[model samples]
Target: MGFLQPNLPQLDLESWRRGTRNERMRPLVAHLCEVGFGTPDVVYLFYVVKIGLYLLGAMAFAVATAGVDGLFSVGDWWSEPIVFQKLVLWTMLFEVLGLGCGFGPLNLRFLPPLGSFLYWLRPGTIRLPPSPALVPGTGGRMQGTVRGPVDVVLYAALLGTLLVALLADGTRSSGDLPGAAGLLPVWLVALPLVLLGVIGLRDKTVFLAARSEVYAAIAVTFLFSGVDMVVGAKLVMLVIWWGAAVSKLNGHFPFVVQAMMSNSPVWRWRRLKHRFHRSFPDDLRPSGLSRALAHGGTAVELSVPLVLVVSSGGWVTAVAATVMIAFHLNIISSIPMGVPLEWNVFMILAILVLFVDKAAYGVGDLSGEGVLVLAVPIGSAVLVVLGNLYPERISFLPGMRYYAGNWDTTVWCFTPSGLDKFDAGTVKAAMLPHQQLERIYGEAEAEVPLFTGYAFRAMHTHGRAHFALVPRACGESHDDDYLVLDGELVAGVVLGWNFGDGHLHDERLVAALQERCGFEPGELRVIVLDAQPIHRPTQSYRLVDAATGELERGTVLVADMVVRQPWDTDLPITVTPAPQVEC
Candidate 1:
């Protein structure tokens, strides 16, 4: 790949457009398998620099908070309880501000290159309520108005409250532990939580964008005192790692590893990328190497934290900490597409702060809270179970299944006019998917990046399944009448930011779009695929028309997806067409 330019596929536009779906996807798939995203070295370097800046900014926050003296002096202050708490707050601020996860070209974001705070802080921006029917005082003008002054103020207040809390000096503790000198005031921590939760009720966008599910839970632990605070933080990390690991015990995970490793810039050789797949075209399941990496990584995630939490300042603690740090570093070095660089960095810092440095704060160190100690992990475990069983009900973030390949995914097939209607209809921060491509590559050349996106989606197992099922989902609609885009791209346009979750664009989002755009039955067709359950080989899928409603619901076996090449769209689907429901 060129330093400034992406390697583009050499294809005759007229012939490519007229070709069969698989015919069009074939060249792109070969290109991707060999070149990955074909992302330029310059772009990768840019993200690396951004990662450096993020770490420096966190260190600066730590120093400014009087938690550390110098950047290199982490050895001296790394264990400070308040420092860790402020780091969590600081990371949350960074993410909510649109600079953390799902930022820039890697996530197919351009123009503004981000959408979280940009969308949330603006009045008249769209906000998706999780459940408008169930929540009282949630309907009427408050439901989906142009974000009024109050919404903007509330979002700004959440940001401001978080900043103030990060800057606030924690009260000195009457403890003997070396790092347990100060604690964030309960009210200071609680204020942002309440504000975030309240704003989230109105805008699930802000909630998911802030990653309130992960960071907010950690922030709540800051409200506790003494050993409870330490134990609470430890439990939260355990949930994150354990939950993610547990979620990986499935048929879909190997596919994720194969795709992720193929996309890894660190693994530059095409041969290495090819090895992850079973073969070129016929047998495209994840290779043995991919499965080993997937399962081994899962084991590390599941086992290391347990060893870290239990080992009380011995060589065992040292080895576990090293493994955990290396684990996160490996992920960071891979430079995954979502560019969750800062999140991985934060996890590394967390290992040092909570596990290695605060090693003594185990279950035996628990203070007044006995039963409550088990509640957080147990509750998180239950969510993981429910999340896996019925993924439609929970966001993947809360489900804690980070990068385990399996995720709720959707594909929206839109007519050209339908795309225009969406642009005219929705109150959004970013341009439509095609529009963003146009801005970056120019109107004349936009289709290049546009189809490159399709290829990227096809690299994943769900992409193959979703697109393969689209014809059946949309009925016998003419191919030229619509364009296919990942639901994350649609979510980016509608919800501000999407970190690879289809829940953002499921039936709920369909209704929201229909309410605004009034799309005709053929204008917009969506397929929502749920993450696969651990014990089951099949994953559930739902099809809905933007104008009409549910059209089909079904299951696609994992075996069908992994066996096909990236360009292949002939996956066997088991459909249960639903009676047409009105919007």
Candidate 2:
């Protein structure tokens, strides 16, 4: 019976194969499956759109550069070939477009509306639920599995193109435009295409690597290009000025001649100073042993740009090159492990300036010599008067109070000492009033005369409290004094205290609160404490609250008050009301 059943299925299969529908649709089904598995039509569409946008951005850059004569000067002579210049221009355009796409919203319009609409139409896509397959881990695994075939095809294409380009003869051009090499352009285009192919195939890994490489390339190119542009611009300006002078001399105008001669010496002096300053400054400070050692670790830091500049042309070219170098150094310094070269260059220019005038105007000329001699003394006298009028050595301590302003509303009381002292148990019984007095007041009262003299001056000038303790004064005493001042019990003390100075004792703090604010011992209430620091010369508090302290619990009785170091002063503080107890 089982054999008969199998034979019956075989007969049915034979009948189905012979039917008209199977015969008509087999090839079409196969073709559809092949296209679905092998081609990525969407990716190609994106690439075309991106290229168009890049071309548009490049055109914009070129137009902008044309208006700024200082940016795109070709100079009287061109060192680089026309082809090389074109390549640079294209590369710059690509960079600009890439940068715009990354930072700006210009590329968002390229996404296919049809695909987005289709995605929204699907219930699963529009309202995704938490499914195991949709989780990150599953998606990552799927991506990993799918990427292998794409990577193989991409790498194979890249390798084949590279090998063909390398092996092809440059002299014997195979394509049209005979005898002229067509391969160079092909190679140039292929290089970036291969890079993009590899980057696209690798997915996330390629994204990070490509992003870093693109940024670095853009930065390096900008530095070199800027230097080239500056030098070229300066040369063009010099030529223009020289031409104008020659035209005036050739003309038959008496006024032009007189004007040219009258300004001749001044122009000459300016040119001399500009050249000297551009090369080396008047205050060129060289690196000492320590500085040299530090800088020497990065040998290429300064040498690479110097080499590029020297190779391009000598000191004249170096001026623009050095400026670019300084710019790059400034950028790197903004990161880490780098120092800005601008200050160093400025110092060099200063040193150069002192002697530049003397060299340009010889000692034999009375007018030139007199001006040069008087420059230093005249500059010194002016600086001296300014320095005396506005002394830089004003005391920070004396200005604290003026800077802090009103203290009572801004101050916070947190310690038990700032509360009622008479109700506590065993310790209160043993110590009595004398012990309580010693614990609360400490030696600070005795030393207040000495410390207050300085503190009062600081408070009066700064309008803020100095929380620092007097030397030889007890810790509790310092806290008491600071609290008293902060609570407005003391007439002249600034309200704020530096957490570093041990001014957070509970007993002293509570005593000040009780003495000044009229809060009874063991009374619990929510209190908000401000933690702003007072700035000198501006009597304002940049307030912040306590973060993680007894006050952070939201609600708790004043069970214990302990003073700890203040690290982050701007955190929020929340205090809970305490239960009242009979004394």
Candidate 3:
């Protein structure tokens, strides 16, 4: 890669465009292998400024809460329940505002750089309700753009109520911590939570987009007063760590670590980056080092929180807190794609507030509590287990599987006309992917970023399966007939917000597109890949022809996937072709 300009493919324009998709991607892959994404220095600086701004915003909110004083003097009120509750609401507001994850150019969000609130508050925008057929009154049309004026007004109210709740000062609680403020008024927090729940039923996009899984779970804790509130928060954090660790016990996670390390802005040495993979070309499997990192990281996530929860202050608490803070700091510094930056910041604060500062609230403290105390964590664990076993039925956020790399993913192949249909049909925040590319970098230069994105996906194990399914989905049609796009990008355009969740665009999404675009049977094909179960070595897949419905259903071996390079398209596939009955 170049010092200033990204290293362009070393080929003549005609020759570059003449090659097949993966063929043209070879040089781009090599470039990424050396300098992943090669994100400009200015972009990194911009993120740094944003992180500072988020931190400053949180501190300002902290001060506004009754007991809190200056930012530097957080020690005086850091353990206050109100302080922590406000932080949770504040972070949720930040995320739902579109300033959080999936923000900016790294996620290919250039035009407005965000989609959350922009799409949610607009009356004509699309809202994806999970499984409309299963619920009454939600059965109008499965297409994503089905929001009515009521949906828009409710969404706006949810946002507004949350802000008001966050700004509302705490009322006195019966808790024991001296000089520390009580909780935000029960109704203040409760009203917003209820609105969030109601809006979520109508549209899961707004829920997951706000990271409702994390913040909502935390808000549920505020309902309990005194020591129970502290214990509830502690248990929620435990679920996040342990649940994420358990989810990572799959063959796919090592590949995630390898890819993330290579793309890490902090790890700038090209030699060190290459070490994460087995070889430059012949083999691209995760290296021994990547496997060790994944295992070691999992161990920390699973075990350290236990120590943090049980230890009552002093050396043990201090040590565990420092280690976990460093852990989050490392992830933050890496600048992982999807830019889940603010989430990491919140985790750091959680460690300090729930575990370190208020270290007295341990497992023993829960003995004073009722059955409800045990129920919340137990319920969260059950949900995690269910999500792992049946990913199609649950969003990964609630599943508590952050960055396991084994996620339900999809790849959409659209013919030029199919792409045009999407542009004409959707309520869009930005132009379609290729159009945006061309607008920024002329038609000729557009292939640079375009192919770079393909290489990025190919770097993961799922990329192989996605491509392997393409032929089966396409059948007799030439592969180049369709422009392949990540389902997340399509989700961002259609659903308004997406943070790496495949639930946003599964079979239901295919129906939605067909309803709007009315594509020919062969014009649009989709590959939906489910995350592997913790107990299983294979992941399931479905290929749907938009106009005609599902063409096949089957499984892809995780064993076969982990062994190949990201660009290797020869991965084996098992198909159960469906009997086509015309609708």
The prediction achieving the highest TM-score against the true structure is: 3
Could you tell me which residue pairs clash in candidate 3?
none
lDDT of 1 by residue, 1-583 (tens): 7888887778888878777665677777767766777788898898889888887777777776644577778777777778888889989999998898999888878777888877877777667777777764446653463466777899899889988887777675725456534777789989999998887777777888888767888887766666777787788888889989988887778877877787787888877788887886545667999999999999999999999888888899999999999999999988888888899899898888888777877887777654365666667778887887777788898888788788989888888888888989888867876887787778867876777677767777787887788788766664566788888888887778889877788877887788788898778988889988777888898888888887888899988887777777678888876578899
Q: Tens-digit lDDT track for model 3 on 1-583?
A: 3434554445687878887777777777666666778787677788889999998887787788776777888667776778788889988888878899989877888887887777777877777777576655567654434888878888788778878876677786736654466678888888888888887777888888788878888788877766777788788888888999999988878878887887887888888878887886556678899999999999999999899988889999999999899899999998998999989999999999888778987656654553476677778889899988877678888997788988899989888888888778778877766678798879988877888888877878888888778777776454568888899999888877778999898877778777877898778889999988777888899988898888789999989998877777788887767678999
Candidate 1 vs candidate 2: which has greater TM-score?
1
Rank by lDDT, highest first: 3, 1, 2
Task: List the RMSD of every prediction in angstroms.
Answer: 2.5, 34.1, 2.2
TM-score-better candidate, 1 vs 3: 3
> What ranking emerges by TM-score with the best candidate at the front?
3, 1, 2
* C-alpha lDDT score of every prediction, in listed order: 0.80, 0.25, 0.81
The Cα error of candidate 2 at residue 486, in Å, is 43
Query: Total backbone clashes of model 2?
Result: 39
Among all windows of 10 consecutive residues in model 3, the one with the lowest summed lDDT is: 1-10
- Backbone collision tally, model 3: 0
What are the clashing pairs of model 1? 124-147
TM for candidate 2 is 0.19
- Tell me the lDDT of candidate 3: 0.81
Task: Give the least accurate 10-residue stretch of model 1, judged by summed lDDT.
Answer: 137-146
For all predicted structures, in order, the TM-scores are 0.94, 0.19, 0.95
Best by lDDT: 3
